[model samples]
Target: MITLISSDKRKFHVLEEVANQSLTIRDVIEDRRGRRRADRIILVTNINSKIPEKVIVYWLRHFLMPEEIAHASMSHKKAEKLKKWEAKFFDTDIDTLNDLILAADSLDIPSLFDGACEKVSDILKNRSAEEVGEISKIENEFTHEEEEEEIPSENAWVWRNEFA
Candidate 1:
């Protein structure tokens, strides 16, 4: 087993095989294969305790069905089930999703990264500009004049509505 220490000093003991889903952890384990047991402790300094817990949950879920997923031989029903499961798993607030994205990227877990990114995109899609900004907690810094006049004038083609 390898111990993953979160930034908040929480320790998660994970089987090497389950943790191997993370390329970074796999590489670290590979590099310290013959070392003492102390080497098995990996400090994930960039991610807090909550994220690691979520990541571990994600890893465990994927680990349970890696072969079925990788082989492309899973039954249609199973695929649909897994898709539904993923949708529910990723249905979280934007801040948590963003944190998951960063943790996944840092851990080199592409599947998790992709899933979290897709969730974030889904939350933003087809929304008005103000809605998107509000959901994402991004302040619109442009003043009234800049928004109504300067920006539209600068990007005239975008505001033309000719296609519509």
Candidate 2:
């Protein structure tokens, strides 16, 4: 088992295999291989307690798989079940989702990072720039003239009545 320490001093105990899903944690473990598990504590100072707690939950949910099962093609039923679980897992508020994305990126967990990115992309799809900005909590920095000229020119298809 590995003990992960969050920035706020929260401690999470997780299986070494599950924690190794994060390359950063894996590196730490490897570097401390000579030491006992009890002596090894990975301090994730970049992320706060809440974010690391969520990350630990995500890691546990996506725990270790056998090498053969990991590499081989999954059955449709299993695949669909995993898809549903992922959808539900990522069905969080935008702020939490953004935090998850950043945490995943920092931890070097590609699957989580990609999943979060896809979820954010789904929210952005078929939405106007204003809506995207609102959903992503980004202020529209473009001037009115820039919006008028660039939006229609670059996204003419989105401006069409049928598309809208």
Highest lDDT model number? 1
* Residue range with the least summed lDDT across 10 consecutive positions in model 2: 62-71
Residue-wise C-alpha lDDT for candidate 2, range 1-164, written one tens digit per residue: 88878878889888888888898889988888988767777777866788878787778767744325544876778767777888998998888888898888888998899999999888889987678888887897889987889876888875578743
Candidate 1 residue 26 C-alpha distance from true site, Å: 0.9
Clashing pairs in 1: none
lDDT of each: 0.89, 0.81
Give each model a TM-score. Answer: 0.88, 0.81
User: Given candidate 2, what's the lDDT at residue 88?
Assistant: 94
- In every candidate, how many clashes are there? 0, 0
lDDT of 2: 0.81
Give the runs in model 1 whose Cα sits over 4 Å from its true position.
67-71, 143-145, 154-164
